[model samples]
Every structure is written in structure tokens, then in C-alpha cells.
Target: MTTPAWENVSDAFMRNDKPYGGGAFRIRDSEVMTLKVTGPDTPFKPASEWKNPEIAEHTEPWMNNSGERLSRSTASFIRGTLDSGMTRYFQQQAQDGAWWYSKDWAAQYISTGWMDFTRQEPVNGLAPQITRLWRSIDGGRTWTQLKWPEDRNISYLKFLDPQRGYAIGWGPNVWRTADGGQTWQAIALPPMATDYRKPRKQFDAVDLGPDGLLRVAYYVGMLGEVRLSSVVYRLPWDKAQFEPDVVLPDQVVVRLGSTEEPPGHTYSIYALSRLGPQQTDGDQNDNGKRTGAISMWPGHRNPAVRQLQTFDERYSLTDMDVGKRGVLLVYAGDSSRRGAPHQITLYSQDYGKSWKDIDDGMTQGGWFDSLTNTQYALYAYTLRKRQF
Candidate 1:
């Protein structure tokens, strides 16, 4: 636990050209951002088009729960004409760079709740999947979608009210939609169980708590014996089934808490981790250009291995937020080469159990969204940022 030298407080933050990732949320005053650019003829798109063509010609707004604001412009123009053939299959994979688009996506209205977003079209074909949800109705804005079927493939999303929310992903899949996401369930793991045919269990990380409870971490075995574990889950709103009663063995790279509840202990969960990296020595190729390091499996209990010489060593945690005292936003690196420089690490105070990273000044990868409370970012080169 002695790793602090993020290049000197990372220059005190500050790199807000607006665009961030693929997430952002905060309604009431107005805020909704999303990104994933490079379409219209491709070539990595982005010759400036951060939206506001008079709010894209006054349309794309949908809020209810009371925060008011309607005219989804016909459901955002029929989801933008069914996403124009998925934007020409992501502009031919961003014309060879593979993918890039997400400067942050947006949608908010908050009076009780209202957040919505959708995109999922690369299933067996792989890549491409985004889903965000939030809906509370003290009665207004008519929203409802949070139910959690593993949240489908939620890259990143956040919520602090209505019922509490949080989300993250790389693989082991972490979720906690509550009633806001309509339904998402899974939490309470850790007892040493990594062998899903190996492959770093695909990759996983997630955190959420304002009380509803949820914390997850993953990495099992097979690449120099990788091993990382963490779990904690207990989402009760009257319980209809949202398991993860408590599976803490320790491997939680980060976690933040609070979903309200206090009276008799209805919800509360927190966990964090960071100690996995060390197996470096070149040529381990995953192709997209190396950059994959997160190993950890040597005597367990706070083992070591992190940021090994950094260099496209693919790493990932996620933007888990509890905000204002619990900010945990971690987006590891490695984007197959070509330009690198997309590292997002912002851990503020406790929500991450204990961290201080900050430095969110880079772009390229994409993913991360928060609703109700407000914060959105999406990228792959489409660039979008919203805080206002």
C-alpha cells in the first residue's frame, strides 16, 4: 500500500474541454451528455461537433418525474433513425482505429427521477453496448427501465437517489439498478472462484452505495496466475430478489456507499481493492496493441502488483460514484496503441474506501454514465461532455 506518485497531484486536475467519456448526469438545472463519434464519413471524425446546433435543432429532450422537459423529438428521432445503420457499423470501426466515440452522453430531469439512454447492437458480433436507466415518479416525466438483467452491458452509469444506483463493467459484470434501472441483480461473491475458462474472467469492476449496497471486483486465473476477488451485495427496497448478502474476502479495488436506509439496517455495503500487477516481460499480445496488466495472485491478502511500468498495459476499474465525499472514477488504459493517452483516474475521498488519484485529462476509449445525480461521458471518438 505504498503507491503514490501520480505525477504530482496530476497538475491539480483541470482538462475539461467538456468531452470526457460516455456518461454524465445531473438534472433539475439541466445536464445530459453522451458521445461516440467518427461517423459522417469517418476518418476518426470530430472536426468539431460538440452538439448545440441549437440543441441539435431543439429536439432530443425527454424528462418527466417533474423535472419537466419533453419533446424527445419523436424518441430522439426514432433513436436517430435506428442509429443510422449503427452509424455505418461504427463508421467502419472508426476507419481502422477500431473504435472511438463518446465524449459523454446526457439525459436528466430529477425532481424525483428521470434518466434514459439506450444502445446495444454488438452482441455475438462483439463490442458496442450501452444502456443507462433511471426513473422515479413522485409522479411526472414517466420513466421506468431499471430492472437489471445484468444491466445488459452497461459500460458505466450512476444514480444517488430514488432508490440508489451504480454500475461498472469489464466482465465479471457488476450492477445494482435498484428500482431505477428497472431491475439488476448480482452481488455477494468472493470465496475464491475464478476459473470461468480463464482469461482474467474477462475483466470486471463496479461499486454503488448510498445504501442499496454493491461492490465487486474480478480477475481469476490463467495469465501468470492472475487472482483478484471482492464482493458485497445487499439491495433491499422491500426485497423481491436482489442477492449478494455479503461475500467479502478482500479484493475490492474501490467502493463507495450510501442508499439511505438507516432505521433498522435495510442497506449498506462498501469495498475496495488495488494490488494486482506484476508479470511484465513483453510479448503477451492480445493484438489491439498490448496494454493489459492487472495480475494478482500470490499469497492473497493484500498482495501486490500495480501499474507495472505503464505502457498500454490494458487496465480497467470504473467510474463508481457516491459523489461529494465518495467519488471513485477509475478507467484503466490500453487502447491497442495508435496514440494511447486515455487514462482516467479520479478517486476523491472515501467512496472508494480510500484514494486520491484525480487526474482526468485524456481521451479516446469511452464509457461512463451517471443519471439522476447527473454526470455523463461516452467516447470511442464521438466526443461528448455534459455537466451543465
Candidate 2:
């Protein structure tokens, strides 16, 4: 049967739990498209109910940080005006131990989105640090600090699994940990040119390919003439070292050139997509433009490893989630024209080949927390989705 006919039949059987008799099924043809039917006991939970109840009461107090109770006039204004759904979600997070608040900063986690960690206060008379790092295994209820070396600057953090992970900081170095954050070891880095007296750059982002290879991007040097470097390296999870395996095509350099003028400097390389050998071809005409074939090197110490074709776009990628089919790239942008209201954009369903934007309906102002599947009670204005 044609798709429409099949859909009609499917819908008819689903709604009545049987087909209409005498074949006179005259329900609007489009109505037949509704296949799933929800009943009274079909498990409907209000957005408020999904929140942890314990946290709900503290929502306003947490936001204002004032013990004073609001007058009826003020309370009515807030309730009738602001959309409190996001607030309730955040409150739940705090109650569940996923909500993190220091004297200087506060953050909550949304499942599978950008993990938004902001600096709440200044320590030792420094600026309020709004750095995003660390991952939570039990949702946002608790977070494990993923610090780098003696210095507290954490350039980036990537966890392929709960156990295997990699991070880099303000030096030409990468750190690896096999047992979560319990122990860490430094990875061997390739040599830079003698004139490369640029300050050792930090890895801005790291991603693991489906094949288990790791790719990293970072920036080096001072203002005006900063060098945004992209390096594709292979490290066996079994061993604690990284052997320079492949370098992404130089076209990346050209792309960066277009973004940053003469003395090119990159703001950030936030995300990476891994493509198969066939899709890596750079010469293929894309959107009516000739593109260069990206080069990929395989094997270690081969002296003469062949270059393969694969193309991937790196952005100020805020967060990345890899699925079975493709990778999701989330970056900071202003999708809405509400004056400086930034948002997280999703480059959805591209197998490192091409990206399409998706609208997941997130709000501005608040930062993203860790993504997980854990559920909790709703009590306050903020609710936190926990990771188990």
C-alpha cells in the first residue's frame, strides 16, 4: 500500500483498537495520522510535578538570596509574568545536590546539553570565574572537579566513557586519565618549530572518534597573532601515551584564515566531528563550491603515512554529544533577536559530513549543566535532571 494508505489503516486500528466496519472509515484522512492515543491513566505529569518538591519552596529565596518574604504585590507580579518552568527545573537540581552554588557563582544541569559552569565569586581578589569543566556521574547532584596540574586553569575536558577521558590546559600538553579523575598522566606532544616561541597553547576541545581515536584543537600565542592549532592524535586506551597519528588537512588553516584576518587568531575550536575515509574528501563540490580534500594520517612512525579524505567543521563548539549516526555540535549564538540574549545552537544529525541546525527550545541567561537521565522530585523554582 502507499504510505498514506498504510498510515490511514494503522491509525484506524490504533484508535478504536480495531478497524472501522464496512470500510466506510470516513474520518478525515489527516486525522488518521494520529497513531498514538493517550488515555486518562496514560501517565501525564505536569511540568511542575516533574520537579523535585523539596526544592520548589526555595526557588524565590535562592534567586534573591534574601530571607525576606515577598509582599503579595511582588509575588503576584512574578508569578504572572516570568516563565517559571526553567526556574522550577533549576530549584529541583539544587535540592538533589546537582545544583552547585558558591558565594560567587551558581549553575544547574540540563540533560545532554552544554554543561554550564560559571564563576560565582572571586577568590584572592580575582575576576568572577565562569569556567565550564567537570562532569557529574549522578546527574547534576554532584560534580567531580577535573583540574589541570598545579595551575587551576582547565582549558577543556572530554570524557569518552565514564572512565577514559582527556583534558588539556594553557600548555602544549594533553592529560589522560583511565580511572575517571582518580589518577592522571600527561600525553606526549609533537614538537613545534624552533621559532614557535608562542606561549604553549592549551587544548580548547577534545573528542573521541567512533574508532576510538582522539582529536584536539587549541590556541597558542598572545593577542592579535594567536595561532589556533588543530591536531589529530591517536592514543591507545591501554597505554598512557599519545603518538602523533594524523594531522587534519591544511584547509582548516584556510578556513580559520577567513575568520581571522592577517595575523590570524581563533576565538575557539569548540567541537570536532569524525568522518569515515570516504566522506573525508575535500575536493567534492559542496553547496556549489569546490572544497579541498582533508588529509588524515594513520599508523605511528610510518614516516610516510598516506593522506585520506575527510572534512569536519570546528566551531566555538560549547558541547558535543556523539550518537550512533552522527555528532551534535552545540555552540553559543543568538538565535533570537532579544538583544544580547545568547543561545545554544545544535548542529544536528551530521556524521561529521554536514550539519543541520535544530531548535531544542532552551532559554537564555542561565548556563547549561551536565546531561543525564536521572529523575528527581520538584519542590522549588529550579529543577535539576540528575545523572545516575
TM-scores of all predicted structures: 0.24, 0.37
lDDT of 2: 0.32
Output the lDDT of residue 384, model 1: 40
Native-structure RMSD, model 1: 20.8
| RMSD for each of the candidates | 20.8, 17.7
lDDT of 1 at 131: 35
Model 2 earns a TM-score of 0.37
lDDT (tens digit, per residue) of candidate 1 on 109-160: 1211112222243444343323333342422223443344322444555555
Question: After superposition, which runs of candidate 2 have C-alpha atoms over 4 Å from their true positions?
Answer: 1-152, 157-164, 179-182, 193-200, 210-212, 219-229, 249-321, 326-362, 365-388
Span of ten consecutive residues with least summed lDDT in model 2: 71-80
Q: Please tell me which predicted candidate would have the highest lDDT against the true structure.
A: 1
lDDT of all predictions? 0.33, 0.32
Writing each residue's lDDT as its tens digit, candidate 2 over 1-388 gives 1111101122112222221111101112122111111111122245475466554332333333321211110100000111211111111111001111221122211111111123343454333212233444542345555443433334445455566666654455666777766677877764441124334444434545433456554322322232333344456666655665434432232211001112222211123323212122465644322232222232234434233233223222233433332323334343234554443344434333544443223431122222221221111222222221
